[model samples]
Target: MGLRPAHPFLRRVPHSRGLRRLRRLTRRDPVQLLKQLPEQEQRARLLELLRADLQSNEEIADETWQMPSLTADGRTADLPGFNFQTRVCDLQILQGVSGEAMENLTKTCRLLFPLDGSSWMPCTADPRCLAERLAQEVFEFHAKGFAFDPKRSGAEWWVQIRDSGHSEEGIQFHWDTDEVAVERHGVNVHPHLSTVTYLTECGAPTLILQCRNSLRPSETAQVYGSLAGGTLSWPKLWKHLAFDGQLLHGTVPKALAKRLGDLPHRFTFSAFQAMPRWSPVSCHAGRFRTRFGRRRLLHEISCRLPHRSGDTTAGTLQLHWASKDAMLGPVEKGRKREMVSAGGGEKKGCLKGEIH
Candidate 1:
């Protein structure tokens, strides 16, 4: 048998005139064009171009990981304080596996989001391990990234993984503990870290938080915009409280806050309740006692209870303060918001919040 030549048509496709024209169109300096056009016109044109690009890329076979299909219909996990922020109305549904989970989810803004494909991107190792993984990842990432001062600072980190779903298509994300405080401060609270994945094909992993924490029944929640799948890390918790970093950085002027009464603090209470899978005592012995509260501090022991049993609630309540202490601050009532360092004395009351 003789070796055969590859198709010349395939080899020469790159030099096609159509491709050349497309390259020319896409290669133009968008900044230069924007400079030439009126500001409003420039913004409109850019949006149109972006929409066109997104639409055109739909047919392009994504070279990245294959997105998981929603094979499992839907499953829900109901636990205490699941909706402390929004009443017992929080709901989280497990869809399926996403691509390689990333760390430091908040820092995703640094890298352009991979918008060329349809896929679920998880931040934790396994679906069951979501909360644990989220907590650990946030801790390690922030510990390394944020230069916290131990002497003058009692800075705390709060982490919560919420189940966000609606109809057939939806998403879930990590909520900050300081959400309530941020609303009061009219400042941005760093999400610090978050993990998000889409449920449907057209579903994008976007975090939509209402500004001013709207109370009107007729008004809908504000849309924060699409969040890329990955880890985001930041120093102070105050920086992420706003709607969009673009507006925060002044890269783009926004009318949302002024027009819609959108304050940086407006956000609906996240509806995912966190159940503590592990306690500080599990981390060590002397450490657990030192970290937990002296008022209700009980011996470190594991006792199985029904999914919704009263005993489980009691157990969760006991460990709640300790967990918050461990995670630092920005604690939410009802959910495990922090982790107590083994042996650290419980010096603070449940950092001010309604226990879900």
Candidate 2:
């Protein structure tokens, strides 16, 4: 037969009067309704609507590219007074890919991260494969090989989607510590080299700081001295930036906000490679170990900071963290606190005093 006609029943479902009325009532102006809500509520509703739209049109990239092989040593000379080199390069990692494909990947990643879950969202790529690809590239360029501990390491690619307009504060200036890394990965290991690849047009320029002293645990060691620092930004395509993770780094909020405003979206694919454990230079200089001979674990410590908004001073809460219990005092302006035993030995006394 050349063609077939559709049956009457298959053509359309007749709507009842009640269903028609319900549809009409539900078709109100979403923007007007959003305007009636508070700013926070408006944002929440908009995000929910955006998520629904993204979920319906989710597309995963099936195309794979050959991992680039290192031809010549691409490591940069270490900066003066710094143990590691901060490297930036434009790679053809996503070469032959289209703008539309990259956009889809970014949206998929953003949808993967549940709003209530951790900031990190796992990548669709095989962790081992991605790790190996990165290790080869890093070795070829920086002469640094990642310490791949699959059993106890969470060293894999991830994505971070940030809405700069809604972000309370830009990421504060901070250095990477093994304590945080261990919390992410089960092992007490920190990334020697951190790589960032932008998957969307909206991108932020990272600020890298060079301090006067090595960031080790010492009575005289300050959290940061800011001997020197510079901003690094790259195109949204296939370019990548690699840096010494231990060095203090943060984003330029103004620049990031501009990018986000221009594109209305921002996200990146990032990977962290733990330093080779056997290397003497890889040790975090006792930063990962505590005074009590216990392994330093990550602990969040919040403190009140003298926040100044232009000419006015507005008191604001700030968050600091200690690698271990003993370090909390220094992190929180000499605030003395006791670590009650995990057992019920001092339950009554603990209730009488604040824990932090």
Candidate 3:
């Protein structure tokens, strides 16, 4: 029997009676609630939503696409075409933590998982302690069916000092989420949702995206959005990794294509996304292994690829949480480097005591 792909939408919490009642009480239409944000925020949120949806659909298509791999022994490897690669894959489910909790977690992650090198936090509140606290809070919230205000929450969050802008040699990020690529007369119907955020704003590298199969340098590669004061959220988290550059091909419709051809510039907008990293732990005979370690291994795997970067900013942080029933295809045996830039870069060991 051939392996099948799992639909990420199935994991979504449907609009049950209790959920609808809660939404009514909160006056938050989870589907159309994004319009309530500021104009810039609204655009960013919409872009993310569309990008995620498109990416999911693409993944479904790719999984079903007939592109089996041939092994060294001439055997057929049942899988989709090797089109996209994950720059980073980190996954975590935030429970009791408010938006503030997620902020603090991001800070901790930047400190703990620097691309340039490792840096230590002065405080005792490390990743493990924070994860435990978040888990407990999430459990409580799930049990009680209530939402906490991240801004007003009286939680003591540790904030990392960040630069106002990127350094000349900034980091880069690229990704694809699932969506339909049928562009109309002139509109670019982005089918997936993907995001890239910069940690060290100083010398932050500009973003660049293009069609995966474009022969020339790029017809549509330029920088987009800033992560300084933005937040991005989709209907759910799993939707983030459903598509990539492959589906991005032929995604832009004629109208936007004309504008893009005329302007030939990246879309600079304000956006925010919560990139949560979780640790997968296992214990056998009292010995333990953390997902962080597994991720490091994955990073090492990426490091070995032929397409490596001399600049330390080239690395990406991947986060994911695997469920037993998730229908992930077999792990192919070779390096598959992603051509897109999904996340921003970080300066090595250059944490300033305070932002200037």
* Local accuracy by lDDT, each model: 0.23, 0.31, 0.24
**TM-score of every prediction relative to native:** 0.19, 0.39, 0.22
- Rank list by TM-score: 2, 3, 1
| TM-score pick, better of 1 and 3 | 3
Query: Where in model 1 is the C-alpha error above 4 Å?
Result: 1-36, 40-44, 57-356
Question: What is the C-alpha lDDT profile of model 1 across 250-326, one tens digit per residue?
Answer: 00001111111112222222323332333334432111111112233211211111112122321111121132232
Q: Write the per-residue lDDT of candidate 3 for residues 269-311, one digit (tens) a residue.
A: 2112223321123111111110101111111101001111111
How well does model 2 score by local distance difference test? 0.31
Model 2: how far is 247 from its true place, Å?
A: 0.8
TM-score between model 3 and native: 0.22
For 241-332, candidate 2 gives per-residue lDDT tens digits of 56665444444343223421232224333332221111112222111111111223222222111111112111011112222311322233
Look at candidate 1 and tell me the lDDT of residue 144.
Answer: 39
lDDT of 1 at 127: 21
Minimum summed lDDT over a 10-residue window in model 2 is located at 1-10
The list of candidate 2 runs beyond 4 A from truth reads 1-83, 115-154, 180-189, 212-220, 255-356
In terms of TM-score, how similar is model 2 to the real structure? 0.39
